[model samples]
Target: MTFNITTKNLDTFKSAFIAALLAYIFVYGFELTHFTLSIDEEPLDNFLQTLSAGRWGHALLRHYVLPEPYAPFFTTALSIIILSLSAATSSIYIGLNKLQSISFVIMLAALPQLAYQLEFSNQADTVSLSFLLSVVALFMIEKMSVIRASAFIMLTVVSLSVYQSIFLYAATLTCIRITTDAIKGQIIFRQALKKIFVFSLLITLSLIINSFLAKWTALYFDVTISNYLTSMIGWGKRDVYEVLKSVLIFMRDYLTFKSAYGINAFPFVLLSLITIIILSIKRKRGAPLIILMGFATLLSGFLLNFAIGSGMPPRAMTQIPLVFAGLFAAALVISRVRYIGLIISIIFLCIGSAASNKLFYSDFMAREADQNLSNQIITTIYNNIPNFDEKVTPVFFYGSYSPLNSWKIPSADVFGSSFFDWDGGNNRRMYMYLSTANLIKLKEPNEIQVKNSIVAAKDMPSWPNRNSIKIFDGVVVVKLSDKLSPYNR
Candidate 1:
């Protein structure tokens, strides 16, 4: 009997894995095969050379999975495999039936946030592994023995260390399990409350431990924790009431498609929720609990936003997709009209896949435009600057380039942004791009030289003008724009 059960589990995992793999291939085949570069990946040529920036778990995983010089195909393929494994594990742990399991993996693969995360292909596998660990930790939380609890904490800590945003993913999963089990009559309301309390306490403990470990890791690496992560939380930075209001407003915007990317999942989420509610009411078991938990599941997507007292990028809002997947799964399990649920899931998958294709195609076009502009600037600099030696001439970029390209396709965040226009990293990105392309080895200007170039660039013309590419104080200053704001400088 044990062997038979093991075989069944393996078969379930295999089925889910195949479903997820096919879904991702349909959505991201172009990105997997094509050499695509996003703003962040432009300067991130060597993965190991980069600092951990408080993401020690991601750093460690990248050390093993991604070494040096980004390989688009390899990184993308590995990411797909890891994410498919995560989907399979989730399906097995959640006790999803065959149809629901297929729906779950399909929705997971079609998530827009996953597409955005893959934009930074160098660390995509690490992020995917973090996601897998988050799901695994939640799955382990179901039994809640001493050993399992310890494993849960360890997994949660590692997941957060790799990528903090996935904590919301785990939290949403926990809420989904509690709510769904209660509604399905698998667990009483009292049992649901107890599980919630236990899971919350363990998750809180894991977070505290993660915080301490992060601080220790920073010290050990001789690196100061980046304020980007630390400052995201609004413990003392925001008023309590103000933060609450902002979080609610942000959630409303996100759900209503006011603040979303590509194809919005709001319609599908609403349909799934309605289906679940109607099915639960018909059964008349834990109907009130189902309604309350349904709301909780919806709110779980923005739990991190509530904690941080602000909004986040599309990649950070991964829980939204997870929420959609859970709702669809719940509806599938309870509804007599399983075909309706399956059809909705398939439609969502097709829409999301189409959007993913358009997004990648736009990104490819943007990269081409950026490369053309870079080449033009390089040629102009070499021709205009008398005896310009790239090895010796210190190059400083003042301001940023905003090319007129078709890449601006209504993205909710940084997905469509160009490397040349990435604020505060224009010079580094350009230098790395040139070096990686073997076009030139431009010398990077020091702090003082950069400051001087900024000051001198105020009087110079922007790009396409004769005075845009000029030598200022023995440093080549390429003023891509006239507005030299301190933020971009």
Candidate 2:
């Protein structure tokens, strides 16, 4: 007998292992992998900075997610909570047979676009999926009963309190229930209905509590902080196409194998095909519509972003791909296209996701500044400030998300808790520290109304590699063109 090992098979398996490792790394290093929001690492970072600044008041709203008129938790916080749950469930999937294990992992991975709601986009989304998948795996592995399936369905929807991913959870659960004839028996339906009802009630309560807490926090911080809000009064009525065009440009930043934004266009469509495949196998038809609606929900959310505001970036459509990628993987496994097909599916996801990481996150991970001008200016202040709490040091910026305030500057806000767009509060310290764009605007910002706001010694913009100061009444007013610089501009 002769045995041979092919490099191709080894290579495929090795790559798969490494790919999973990369995802694990990204889970923890998410903060360094994405551009995040302009103000900071999205609201979660701002909320944390608020907490660091002893401004817990604003931190609450900075972390939750919910329907309109009700903020549940900041995207970051939601991601964390959901991811944790999914990971815990993954542990449960372990020790199972290959078919069951793969099924669980595949289904858990193909979830809604709830992960990017925070720092580690895929992690939390995977986690939420794990919970739903766990129930399915349990049904497949243990004493399967209609009551257990129905109860699991209710818990999956109700306990999570995130409606965005609910469609996937609902569809997947219903499929298992009806097709397996586990929970679809009309007599059993009544029990499942009660469970769902109770779950819904609990979800509403959670949302209500979260909303109340977040609103209280923001309001409290608003009192002590003065923020400047640039009035784009006419921005509301500006041409939607222009904004859409601009948004598209920004999103383009994520494509080209440089980032993880494009490619969602096709996968989204593929989801429909996969949905059909899955439905055909299962005796359940209603479940597929539920899954399709899940995609629609994410699309509607993204579309709303474009219609109401300026244009959206094609990259913003990432959520579509992310969720569909999950669905695609599940469909592939369930499709039973031989083990060979399964291998190919994983390969595609690995390569595509890796390319995205490189494109959208390279600058962030590298911390490579586009220009030295912003650096020159911030460096000047940090180096020149004398005796800040016994050190000749200056803090670069202050925000609710920052760690420390600069004592070198008199009346310096320790955190940017108060920033632009406040009607009335205590953020005069921030407006004093202007961006290069604001420095050259000519019109004195009416927002700087605080009594003793620091005088910028260099209001002029400075470019990377060249630093000069233009001071009027001790306020720096010179302009250097380094807007392309990374970190802060």
Candidate 3:
């Protein structure tokens, strides 16, 4: 009996894995096969650099998926496999039937947030591993004992150390689990609350331990923790209110198919929710509690944004897939229309795949445009300077490039934005691009030179103008725009 049970479990996992893998391939195949680089990934050509950001787990595991010779293809494949494993683990932990499992995995693959995470291809595998770890922690803590709780805490810390956003993923999973168990009568409402309380305590403990370890690791490595996330933390009333409002607006936009980074399955999601509600009313269960828990599970994805008192990028909203999956799963369980649910899942998968391909195409075009502009600038520098390579010509960019009219596609966060956009790191990004291309050896201007160049560039013409490229005091100053922001200056 044990052998048969183990074999059955393994087969279920395999089926879930295969379903997830196919769904992911259908949606993100273009990205996995192509070499695409986002702004943050530009500096991660041959090495992983998240250690300084206290992402020791990411830094350590990223070594295995580092894109060396094959560029992005290998890393993308590995990342997809890890993400499929996460889906499989989640399927088993949730105890979904085969059809429900397929629906869940399909929904997971169709997540727009997953696409955003893949944009940073170098870290994609590590992020996927972090997600898998979060699911595993949830699975281990199902029968919470002393040993299980300790293991769950350790796993939670490791997942958070890999990517801080995954805490939301794990928490969202807990919320979904509680709601499902309560609705299915597998656990009473009181037991569900107790489980939630225990899970919350463990998660909190894990967070504290992770925070301290991150600080200690940074200190030991003599590296400063990146303020990218920390700088956003605050309890200011106005900002807090704005973030809360934005969260609601984001949900509305997403559900209405108005959000740029939302899966095009709002109709399906709406239908599923309606079905769940109807079934709850028919069953005469605690409909109010189920509704409340369901909403909490959905909102849990954005809990980090509320805690930080700011908006987060789509990549940080990684639990979005889980939200939709849980909704669909609930509908599948309560409603007799299982085939309809499967059909809707297939439709969602198709739409998501189409969207992913569109995004990949847009990114490809953006990279091409960026490269062409860089090459044009390089050529102009060589032509104008004549002795460009003879001496150290420190390049100073006065303003940043905006692909407003240059590209036809609408920008979605960092998806279609130029690398040279006014993000306060345009100069460094440009330098990195040029260096990586091996087209030209350019020197970065010092702080004083950059300041002086900005002042001098005030009188210079913008790009496409003959006077835009000029040399002053052996520094090559390229003025991209006549208008300069305080950040660029």
Candidate 4:
């Protein structure tokens, strides 16, 4: 059987091809095959929690059915499929040229932090965000029949429930549509009001639905949903000044391209914004909406970052990158000199892609080095200390050194901490190291000490008796300070 080719079908094929190609580059460049669970990945607990609570089914499949170390590849591949659909629908809905769509794909593929999420961080958001994007694309492209509209609403609810960052995408798309209409003078006051009301109503409905579901789940589990709600709202009360500071820091990091490696995205960001403004003005239709788009873009990033609370470790700025990419694509499509815009966009995309690859490559290497160091230290302790296999192993590390670069890791955050932080054994971080190394079945420390100062009897290696070096009975003190090396010791 021969397949008929239409413009829409052709566009879909092109979008899928470009998206798949981009995903392949990202997977190979980031070394996606070498994935390992971080300290926070507790497969059994995650499975029980979601399966029992009745949440996103994809997340449940990821945690329960998929095998460790390679589960990420499956989930990531699923994300690529979703990304392809979203891209195809977006190109059709927005009337983007092939060049613009390719540029969008390149921009998307080069985001450095996204590599971190796909390769290292938990992918609950990956599936959630991908679903959200697909729904948004469908909503935009499809005719607004009652059945289609209802389907969009249902899909939106599920995506929102999985992760609230879906709000950023919703807000960004709505802003773009409204702004485009406003610029064309086609949006009436009543239509504008209706659009705002409908969007707000859908979101409010989703929130209520999520709340009831969460409440029911909490009740089943014999817990309160208030804490979960509170955590989502803010760790505590939102400090306006603190939130602003965080937004600024996020912008600086993204624009300046400041990473562990010195490569930055400032030039790309600057050029993208400049092209957006120029094209917007040249169109003369959407000039006013450009300001609104700018505001929406900033708000998108701020909201996404704020949702994460304390850590602005680059990965949290997920929606923002995609929004910027959308803006760049929009600019390319609308520019008076489309070819010129394409050239500049291509330059930026190439720069971003190279930087993205290098940044993730270095980070992955550093993480591996840290893991090796931790393994060696654990082996040494298991062999040397008497009763090491009998009692709980509590290690107090003061400093860290990466075997790869010999660069000093901060005392507060080290790669070795993942052995405890991510692995399923309590929040303490040491049990994971012991368990992964095929060490003894000694239990984790029972007491949760919030403050410093511990009194441990067993000492390993050249440990000091300083106050910083807290020791407890049946615990081993493992000094992470300099002059500490597996080979040297």
Top TM-score hit? 1
lDDT of each: 0.77, 0.34, 0.75, 0.50
RMSD of 4: 6.5
Instruction: Give the C-alpha miss distance for residue 33 in model 2, angstroms.
Output: 10
lDDT tens digits, residue span 58-130, model 1: 7666656565435768888988899899888877766776677887888876666688788778678888888
State model 1's lDDT. Answer: 0.77
- Which pairs in model 4 have colliding backbones? 39-422, 39-423, 40-422, 257-264, 420-429, 454-471, 455-471, 455-472, 456-471, 456-472
- Estimate the Cα RMSD of every predicted model relative to the unseen true structure: 2.5, 12.8, 2.8, 6.5
Q: Candidate 3 lDDT, tens digit per residue, 1-489? A: 001236667787888899999999888888887777766765643332476677876665555645432256877898889999999888777667777787888887876568888877767887888999999898666666899899999999999988887878878877777666657767667876787788889989998999898888777767677877777765564666676787677666667776555454643566766776777878877776677677787677668766876666667767777888877887777664577777878887887888877787677778788778877888898889888862377988877776542433453667776776747436777777666656565787888888888888889998877579999877888988866656555
Q: Write the per-residue lDDT of candidate 4 for residues 202-253, one digit (tens) a residue.
A: 6666667755765565566564333433454434556877766765675666
Question: How does residue 447 of candidate 4 score in lDDT?
Answer: 44
TM-score of 3: 0.92
- Candidate 1 C-alpha error for residue 312, in Å: 1.0
Off by over 4 Å in 1: 1-6, 45-52, 485-489
Local lDDT at 394 for model 2: 21
Q: Which candidate wins on lDDT?
A: 1
lDDT of 2 at 91: 20
- The better candidate by lDDT, 3 or 4, is 3
lDDT of 2: 0.34
Q: Lowest lDDT 10-mer window, candidate 2?
A: 407-416
Selected candidate, larger TM-score, 3 vs 4: 3
